[model samples]
Target: MRLRVQGLYVMDASKRSAHGNAYFTGFGKAKRIVFFDTLLEKHTLDEIESILAHELGHFKFGHVRQMILQAAIIAFIGFAALYWAFGSETFAGWFGLPHDPGVVLIALLFAKEPVSHLLHPLLAARSRKNEFEADDFARRIVGKEPMISALTRLTRDNLATLTPDPLYAKFYFSHPPVPMRVAQLRGAVEA
Candidate 1:
């Protein structure tokens, strides 16, 4: 069987941010992996390979499409809610705001900001689940040890807090904390 691999791009972002990150970019078969050059500098080769395997897991599991679908659904719901609110006299009277496009735009921005903050726990949880799945993929390909090492190094290099407030993490973090991730991999290895 022939194996097909997509493009890998290394980005220069050392000047922009202290943290290094990676992403899967492009669409369809053209799907590519983009990594910060700093990631390569800071992690070992095995760690990098493990990280790539984790990204491959995302592709194999079709998470990109699922996330895009989820975003589309959220957008539809947001638009529908705005439409309903714009038509309701009570919304205007309670807020004492006029019905204007500019007003609508401002209201939409501010209203959704709060709603997004309110919904953060759920959304972040979903993202963290996906990260776990991807990590599992890495474990299968590169073994648990390599993945755990990679994750630990990545967290350290990125300066992620080992222990963060549960509420703050639950609301904002897309990936599970480093200790939790390392422990999960360690558990799998022991199993």
Candidate 2:
């Protein structure tokens, strides 16, 4: 689908695949955004536009840059910790590994999960905030009705429960709850 917004053409493509899920790629040189065609088929044009607006919000608000910086910092800290831990004979012997090259490799591989687990909650919270900012941008550009309807359809199609545990929502949900989003939109429309 090609959407002309603000004198630029946003082309949504569908060729990128990762772990059986569709990935969207934006080409700065071409000034186009490519996403899975299945998304287009499943959503109305207005909904698609809202999604695109959300993506543009990320671009406009420097969320992508923030994410890149966060990843870099995490990687640096992870590598530093792994290096320090692996250098200690006590740490190596505790994990049943020899103080050798193999031990270093094993530490690198095993450190990923622990690091990810430690950072998951903070990352999830940041992600949810970004989603709300994007939604606000989409609402401003496409109006509350289209964005709310689009969000509802997506929640229903994705089999997302209307209600979820607040703890789970804070720890995992990237987007706000459907009811909360819809209510916000409705309030905006009424105002």
Candidate 3:
């Protein structure tokens, strides 16, 4: 992803990796930001700006640092769990797995999948809260109408349903439901 400010665009090299799944473009000269093609499609100015504003919120609130710290903590915990679970030959034999540290590390990483799945809802809920905070920030800066219109357009473009299962949303979503978001914006506008 890229961030632009005063004619300069900053993008991490990792963004170009084959595993890259997100992209952002901003008017460096204009000090404007944009994120492209995630759950939302690129279409209409309002949609683009709304998404951009949300991303800008991340930058504004230091969410990136929070994400990094969270990842590091999780990784450390995962490693500790792995070590404790397979520290002994007897333990390895009990599981019928190899006793090699390298093999154990790999297995540990794979074993974390279920743990990750179980933690997904909590993570997604935090993410959704962050999204809401960003939306709130965007509305404050750009006015509720633009952000609302942008959100609506992007949701439609992305084929996001107006309503989603609460359980599924908690488990899988990183943003609030579109209708709820729009309502928030509207309420802000009315207030």
Query: How far is each candidate from the true structure, as Cα RMSD in Å?
Result: 2.9, 5.5, 6.6
Task: Supply the global lDDT for candidate 3.
Answer: 0.65
Top TM-score hit? 1
lDDT of each: 0.80, 0.68, 0.65
Candidate 1 vs 3: which has more lDDT: 1
lDDT of 2 by residue, 64-116 (tens): 66877888898788778777776777667777877886776776678678867
Q: What is the lDDT of residue 158 in candidate 1?
A: 85
Between the candidate structures 2 and 3, which one is better when assessed by lDDT?
2
Compared with the true structure, model 3 gives a TM-score of 0.69
How far residue 108's Cα lies from its native spot in candidate 3, in Å, is 3.0
Q: Tell me the spans in candidate 3 whose CA falls farther than 4 Å from its real position.
A: 1-34, 37-47, 89-110, 188-191
Query: Candidate 2: how large is its RMSD?
Result: 5.5
- What tens digits encode model 1's per-residue C-alpha lDDT throughout 103-122? 76677787888888888889
Model 2 worst lDDT run, 10 consecutive residues: 17-26
Candidate 1, clashing residue pairs? none
Task: Give me the runs in candidate 1 sitting further than 4 Å from their true place.
Answer: 1-6, 87-90, 96-104, 188-191
